[model samples]
Structure formats: structure tokens, C-alpha cells
Target: MYADDTVLTVADKEIEIVGRNTHLLFEQTKQYCTANDLVLNENKTIQIIFSTRDHTTTQNITLPGLENKSETKYLGITIDSKLTWKPHIDTLCKKLSSSTYVVRRMMQKGGLDTAKIAYFAL
Candidate 1:
């Protein structure tokens, strides 16, 4: 009925319990949505496991219809499964470089004041 971010996480010291509880929670969410007339959009849903485990270990738990991604962007931040900041920093650097080039071109053309260049940097 409505779209929103829904993240259900179940964690335990035991891997088996974690898998079982996560699956149970998924089932519960399905039941709840059915009772409430809400639909889970698979396209908007992504399953991300935040762990140090390798691909084989992480691949064990799967969300039925949704894709499993190493990284997902939310609110302009890139969040990776292993919690690395590389992607976000890379994005910021690229944007800053592009904006700097525009500002430099404008300055050379005498089209923008230094104050306006400072504003663009911001």
C-alpha cells in the first residue's frame, strides 16, 4: 500500500540460529504485509549482509525475490557489506573535481566572482 525502507535483522553468536531467525523474520514480515494489505516491492528491496565473511559464507542466506548486493546507496551515502568508505569517498572526489573544473573555467572567462567560486566549492 505504501513504500518505505524495511530492514529486518537477526543476529546471534551461532550462524545457524542467525539464518533461522532471519528466515523466520522474513516469513513474519510476509504475513504482516498480507494482513495489513501492504506489498513488498522486490525491485526496491535489497539484502545486504554486513560481515567480514567471504562470498561463499555470505551467499548462504538469501532473500527470495530481492537481489543481494555488496553495496547500496541510501540518502547519498554508499554503504557496502563490509562497511568500507572507499566508494563514498570516490564519489565525493569525482564530484568535487568536476565542480572545480567548472569553477576554474568560469574564473578564466571572468564569469564568476571569487565569492561565487567559494560558494561553488561549498
Candidate 2:
């Protein structure tokens, strides 16, 4: 048995309070997993602080088991701390380029009809 794609979201105006609450929630999750005989994959866990402004003055959020990340993927969308869509758009562009390459290859091998089908399938 395994747990996949578990996410915990804690929001606050102040970063420090959010960090403290996040740590509490993390500890609780760990305890719950232990009681249920499940192992939490700490290595796969990450902490991302979402803020409109850059948090230069504030210290980095430090948790024992999870590494802090500037961005993370959730539900196939790349989310950055600033909540900008740049990362997600970049990822989408790369995927579209790959699909375009496949369609071009199909056109070379078969014809325009095959390429059209491939493009629609993608």
C-alpha cells in the first residue's frame, strides 16, 4: 500500500506564522502515518512559501524533514512562490514543441493526413 500526491496547504499573511503552523501540521501528519503503519517519504516532501513580494528580510523556512523549494508541481501544474504562470507556461510550451516535432516526423514518414491526425491526438 502507498500514499501518493498528498499535499498540505497552509496560508497566512505573515510568513513566520505560516512556517510554524506548517511544522505543526507536518508533525501531526508524521504521527498519523506512524499510527497507521505507513511510512511518510520525507525525501519527496517539499515546502514552498507563496508570497507576492520577495521575502529577502525573512529567514528561510526551516523544517527538519522537508527541503524548501522555490517551486513545486501539483496536479500537473508548476506553481512558483510568486504564483506567476511563467513556469507552467514554460512547461506547456516544451510539451507542445515535442508534440510538434512528432507531428513533423509523421508528416515526413506518411503525409499531411497522418500529421493532422497526430496533431489532433496530441
Q: How accurate is candidate 2 locally (lDDT)?
A: 0.84
Relative to the true structure, candidate 2 reaches a TM of 0.84
Task: Extract clashing residue pairs from model 1.
Answer: none
lDDT of 2 by residue, 43-95 (tens): 88888877788787445356876788989899899999899999999999999
Name the regions of candidate 2 deviating beyond 4 angstroms. 57-60
Best-fitting candidate, scored by TM-score: 2
Model 2 Cα displacement at 30 (Å)? 0.5
Range of the 10 consecutive residues with the lowest summed lDDT in candidate 1 = 54-63
The TM-score values for the models, in the order shown, are 0.77, 0.84
> Can you give the lDDT of residue 4 in candidate 2?
62
TM-score, model 1 to reference = 0.77
Clashes of 1: 0
